[model samples]
Target: MLLVYFLLWVIFNGSFTLEICVFGLVIAGVLLGFSCRFMDYSLAKERKIYRHIFGFCGYCVLLVKEIVKANFGAMHLILTQREEIEPVLVTFHSDLKTQVGKVLLANAITLTPGTITVTLEDSEYRVHCLDRDLAEGLNESEFARYIRKLEEEKQVRKG
Candidate 1:
């Protein structure tokens, strides 16, 4: 995981020789210093991050589909004779067992049009939607379920 993090850091930072050397020393020092804290605590964080990046690949495809659908839905509503719009706020519990997972869920909600995650308390997320149909779709199922599964799979793989 540290290697992956360092590689990603190097890639993003242009992989400069000086920067890589500097980052290598810094990362080594930090890992050694914090080794006690991570001992027996598991590599959940590493797994979560690894899966999170891969998760984005799937999400990118899903996002395109969702965005197109949302655009058409919004377009239909606007072009058709819809006078009284029923905006709604939907509250639901997230299945994400970690803070990182919760954040991912919130970001997913906000990225999709007509839906915004207003707040997340512990595991509960309060999301605002543009209409009842949108609210209904979200309330019926927590999207975090998918994220949770991915995170879980990551943890298992690390084992």
Candidate 2:
């Protein structure tokens, strides 16, 4: 996580100056220290954590692709076939167990152009979609499945 913060800081700064690097290191260290209190420090040494980190990075890339696709689809619908759009509220049960996983999924859904996460109650998510087809894959999406798998792995590690 500190590495992630440092990389983001470096990227945002867009420079390799010694002063910026030192500042980023100090800030990231403080943030990581504060975050450690709320997180399971024991997991820091676990292989499962590394696996989840890599999986999450891949998930982020997948989310960006989905966002692009949704944007084009929504734009096309608005420009050429607005009449065919049947806005609907769809409710689905999410398989993700962790709060972080569930929140990530909800935010990802909301980030897509044609969908909004209306509510999240327990494992159930209510989403408003601009089109029915956009909501159809919510239940069977790879995002939920991957998060579920990650949660399962985490539970197994704990046990």
Candidate 3:
């Protein structure tokens, strides 16, 4: 999946320098070769990876929108005499059970504004949020469930 992304990106935004293109293609081929062994290009695996990439892309778009809203929220708080800011740390346990899922959770947390994943101890995630509302929302559910499900979905296709 990563190899496919690199190849497409190079093709789309390639600078048209033959030497650079050659280097990039070679690197992409090598990475693809290595990943293919692990990825085991079965139909189910391929479908799962495709779905994950699509979902991640969609998640990223939503995250961008949330970031814009958070920016506005932050700005409003800054402009107002009232303090809407309430820094807090929240912890929650999850069932991701894989490094990939944990990494995705960390990344998704980072992608959302005003929230940062501070640690992953076992299945527990310690998140630092800029305010109480974000903290409360985060604490209310297993926000990383989708990421965990994505990882588990792939594990079923493992060779």
Model 1 clash pairs are none
- In angstroms, how far off is 72's CA in candidate 2? 1.8
How well is each residue in 16-98 modelled by candidate 3, as lDDT tens digits?
A: 67776777777767676677777665446677667677767765675577668777876765677875578888888766778
**Winner by lDDT:** 2
Least accurate 10 contiguous residues by lDDT in model 3: 137-146
Query: Which regions in candidate 1 have their CA more than 4 angstroms from the true location?
Result: 1-53, 139-142
All candidates: TM-score? 0.62, 0.68, 0.58
Ranking by TM-score: 2, 1, 3
Candidate 1 positional error at 149, Å: 2.1
| Alpha-carbon RMSD to native, per candidate | 5.7, 4.8, 5.9
Local distance difference test scores for all models: 0.72, 0.84, 0.69
Tens digits of lDDT, candidate 1, 17-39: 98686877688557744763766
The deviation in Å at residue 27 for candidate 3 is 14
